[model samples]
Structure formats: C-alpha cells, structure tokens
Target: MLMLTLLGWLGGYLITTQLIFPPPPPPGDLFEVPDIRGGGLASARERLTGAGLVLGEIDSLLHPSVPEALIIGQSPLPGQVLRPESQVRVTVSLGPQLRSVPDVSGLAEDRAQIVLESSGFLVSVDTARADLPRGRVLEVFPRPDAILPLPARIRMVVSTGPALVAMPLVLGLDREEALILLDSVGLIVSEITEVFRFGRDQGVVVEQEPASDIELERGAKVRLKVGMSGRATEQ
Candidate 1:
C-alpha cells in the first residue's frame, strides 16, 4: 500500500506540472536599440524613444574630456540582444569627467582659453568687464590662482583694451599737481578750458576731462576746465 501511494503521488505531481506550465516564447521578440552613443541628449532621447525605447535616469559621473550632454556611452549597447520591452541596462560615457574648477585670472583670454582647453575646459567671455584689445584676458572667473578640473566651462572678461575707461578725480588739486598726476598716468592734458561757474575765481581748474578717479590706460587725455575770471584793477 505504501509503495502504491508513493507511485500515485509522483504521477500526480508530474501531471500538474505539465498541465500548469508551458514552454517560453521564441527569442526573436525584442526592441532594437538605436545607435546614439555620441549624439546630443535631446536628439538622442528623441531618436531612442522614437525607435520604441525610453531614456533612463541620468547618472552623473566624472569624465576627463568629453563634452557635457553628449552620450559617453549607451544602454543596451548598440546591436546587443535585448527583449522588446526589456529595460536595457546601459552605462553611458559621462563625457570627459568634471574636474575641480581652475582659477584662470590674470591670464590672456586667448592664452586662458588655450590653457583651459588643454586642461579639458571650454571658455566663454564676459564683455561687460572687459577692456580694449579683445585677445587680452582681463579677468577670469574663480579667482586668479586655483586648481580646476577637466571639461570645465569658464566665462572670462576679455580686454578690448581700447574701450573707454573712466577718468580719475583730480578736483581740488593745483594745476601743476593735477598735470603731474595726469601725465604720470596714461593721460594727456587736452587743453584746459576756463569756466566762471558760481562766480569762483578764474584760471583755476573747475572741472576735468574723463571725470575723477576713473580707470584708464596710460596716456589718456583730459580736457581741464580752468576758471578764467580776470581781476579788476585795484585803484
């Protein structure tokens, strides 16, 4: 009886499995992954999804030289076999990894750009803080001297050094003193103009060209306003 019961149990188990389970479908069913490894993010996303896939969460990682938003790598690697709806696990190239921002001040704009590019960075200029002579680098973001990383985006203030600079204040100073100061600096004495505003004496400098205390390159010319009130003859 024990032997018969054991045989019956084994037969039932076999019958249930065959009836409950079926063979898996054939492997030809899957979505094709488009080759977008080095394309722009938006374009890649559009292309990938258009082809029947979705963009996975972006993972930020350090790269040494690749541009940002560029696909460093892709999931489901191009031509790899994956299920149609199977979420492909991809490891994209995070483009040249971001390095610490370098300090690029005091360097010429062109030179700075070259340096930054060599060190894996892209550079841009801020015209507002620039001087004349566009190629000269007037100021660099992140200070003058600091360590920076690759694939860095740097905005610099380039010098159009020829741009006008504000003149420095020299009011209340004697003509000789003013002339000396102006000459010492990059300023020239554009003839001194005499004015009689507010009835204050003549031949005295009333105003200055380029205004007071303005920054300018050496040799800037200033037109001085001198008081020209001639004195009446005292009898």
Candidate 2:
C-alpha cells in the first residue's frame, strides 16, 4: 500500500510540473538578431518577432536618401546573439529635410550665391538684359518663400544692364523724317538747333551730335542740328 501511494504521488507531481505548467527556458539560451536596416517599420517588427525578439524604442530623423518610415539604424546589430525575446531598438528615416528659398532679388550676384549656398541649395547663374545694374540679381527661379527639399538646384537671373542698339543715320534728312527715324529706333531727340543755310539743305538735318552707327542704349538722348534758310534758332 505504501509503495503504491508513493508511485501515485510521483506521477501526480510529474503531470502538474512537467506537463500542465512548464518551467522557463535556461538563462544561457539566446537567439541571433536579424538584420532589419533599410526596411519599413512594420516589416522590421515582423522580422524581429520571427527571430524571437521584440521591437523596442523607435526613433526617427531626416535623411537625404532614405525613404520615410524606413529603418536606417538598428541596435543589437545583425549577427549579434542575445537572450530570446530581447528588445531591439531602431531608428527610422523621416525622409529628406525641407528648406525655404530665401529672397535674393536685387542683391549682388556674389551675395545672392552665398545666401543660397548657406541655406543648403545649389546655385546656377544666368544673365538677362534688364534696367538693374550688371551683376545684380533680377529674379530667382521658384521665387521666394517656396518650400523644397534640401540641396535643390536654384537658378538665378542676373542683370547685364540695359540692351544696346546701334545709332541710326539722321543727317541730310528733313526734320520730320529725322524725328520719325529716331523714334522708330528707340532714340529720343532731346534737343534741336536750327542753322541758316542755303539751297536744298534748307529745312533739313545737317549734322548730329553722336554721328551715325554708334552703339547706344535704348531711349538714349540725341541732339540734332537742322538747316533753316532764314533763321538761326534753337528748338
């Protein structure tokens, strides 16, 4: 009877401890951490779960090349062994940083370039004819206050001063004709002087201050000397 009772007690204890409620694994047992970099957060979590690990603290930061929400760094790096169910911390990318374009219009070319470069932008210079002084910035592409990714290429339109036009021949023509020609060529007749002359030269242009074919800016002032048969007067 005593032997049977002892056997029954041992059987009950085995069933309760070994079968119904099992003990925890030995402390020395560990699992190898899997590589989870360059992957999305969800996928990294799934990978960690499969490797008998748990996802821990998640951090994020702006990256120039990595896509948003993708893992960029991992703790307990790949191939490192750790206790099963260990927490693995990770850092994900928030994508590239954004920057606002600065106002550089009316600034000197060198200064404009400096401002743009200081703001982390690439600059390209192009020239255009404008009333502004040469080497001054006339405008900027994408305008001011525009938001774009960092290291974006910017194009600046710089002024090369006003456009130049060749002076037209006005001597030997009648006053009316000279006026018409100058007006058509964007030249303004600032002053006219009348001189007494004889024969066919009467009432006609005899001389000009800036003789023909001289390069001048549009809307430049021109002085003319016209011939009058009976009067010497300034107009």
Number of the top-ranking candidate, with lDDT as the measure: 2
For model 2 the local lDDT of residue 33 reads 94
Q: Say which candidate scores most in TM-score.
A: 2
Model 2 lDDT at residue 235:
67
Q: Write the per-residue lDDT of candidate 2 for residues 1-235, one digit (tens) a residue.
A: 9999999999999999998998986688789999999999889989999989999999999998888999999998999998888999999999998999999999999999999999999999999999888899999999999998987999999999778888898888889999999999888999999877755688799999798989988888999988876765766
RMSD (Å) of each candidate, 1 decimal = 13.5, 12.4
Encode model 1's per-residue lDDT on 10-99: one tens digit a residue: 988888776667567667766778887666768777876776777776655556766666677777678765654555333445555545
lDDT of 1: 0.66
Give the TM-score of each candidate.
0.34, 0.66
Candidate 1, 193: how far from true, in Å? Answer: 22
Q: Which residue window of length 10 is worst by lDDT in model 1?
A: 226-235
